[model samples]
Target: MLNPIDLHYEWFGVLWLEEENHFPIIVGYWFSKERSEITQDAILSGFSTWTEIGDHSMIMRMYQSIRNKQKKQDWEKRTRLSLRTIFNSPWNEVSPGLYLIKSRDTYPLHVSAILKKKFWVWLEHTAVCETKEELQAFMQRVHEEHQMEISMKNTKPKFL
Candidate 1:
């Protein structure tokens, strides 16, 4: 789970950071999600686009900012929090140099459509896979799963 302290806050928006090779930097407002879906769709969508380009010159990460639920304007008090949820979450090395991370802290609770309460989520990915064989195995499993889903969708139900 995310830090227990996060329960007191809600997501404010997303912060996108880009690491450029050169010292020069360019920043812009990307997108924001307010009381929106808490799923990792936003992160994965951006990551997919990043992978397609195969851009080694730049690296990108998304951070979600949190704001206190209580209303109080105290200049001395800290009320805002931002964390790299995806990267900071726990990861297990499935294979050598191959890491796997789940998207939620607790399975059923975090999988709900609209969160009634706060829960932790981490973006899943293979942190590192040195060989095409390992990557291929992952891709092949996905393909097989997709095929099964399609087959199930096309099947006619045998009503009694």
Candidate 2:
């Protein structure tokens, strides 16, 4: 099993790789205000405690500074929608098995994978992208290449 700390760092790295100057905002709308308040309090207290610890003060400071700076940036101030909202919006119903790749300097590219009826399968390989356009083009090229390879494999030589 993956440790929570490892997962958190991995997610942070991924977001940083995708957005040069921003961190993702994880939001959850709970039916219970008590739970929400409790969670927020815990986070704020945790931040405060970490700030006091001084061991990782530099990292905390850097993250806080970046958060403040991002809040001031025009693009950062805009309301960001969650992937669930984007994919399951009332206006459209996106098919499952779709994934998105985002880069620090580009838009998000949507990609799909083959899957069994309701089971999720992991990709044998991962895709890399430095930009949104690059990501989309990469996916397209990959699909085309795979198709050509499959065609060649399927075609048998004619015998006399």
Candidate 3:
């Protein structure tokens, strides 16, 4: 019997990590009302609670997570849509099982990237701007949200 590590977050419930494994075996329900997406790595590392993972970084995680969800044959058999098709971009496979998809064109308020673990997976994260100013504003909002979450998690019932 393995003891679950309960991370006190609204979305995340009990996290189960194997004693021998460095990676998490089971990371509880991942849900977020915030527009920004957090990654499993960040969740396991507790970085998600304090810092925002960049869109590019999230994209990599999304790709890897989706690939890990099922065997290649099983995944291909299940859907006609490739990951590239789902991403709606001509993603370059920089290395084996690694992808790179970025646009040089800049558009204000434009949705730059959309990432998800799988097609049916409701959890998705997106990058929403093409400019430094927009990115800064977005990060600011994320920082504020993280701070609020931390404060709420730290709040306890004062039994007088």
Model 3, residue 44: distance off in Å is 51
lDDT per residue (tens digit) for residues 1-160 in model 3: 0011221223322233345656534543343333333255446657445333345654345434543452233212322334444343222211112111223233433211112234321111123343668555644543453332211111121110
Q: Evaluate all candidate structures by whole-model CA lDDT and list the values in order.
A: 0.26, 0.30, 0.32
Candidate 3 — which pairs collide?
Answer: none
lDDT of 2 by residue, 59-156 (tens): 34545555345323421222323333433332133233323222223232222222111222222123333355755565565455444221111111
Q: Which numbered prediction scores highest in lDDT against the true structure?
A: 3
Where does candidate 2 stray beyond 4 Å? 1-117, 145-160
Best by TM-score: 2
Candidate with the larger lDDT of 1 and 2? 2
**Whole-structure CA lDDT of model 3:** 0.32
TM-score to native of every candidate shown = 0.15, 0.22, 0.20
* Candidate 2 Cα deviation (angstroms), residue 61: 35
Candidates ranked by TM-score, best first?
2, 3, 1
Error of 1 at 128 (Å): 3.0
Residue 1 error for model 2, in Å? 32
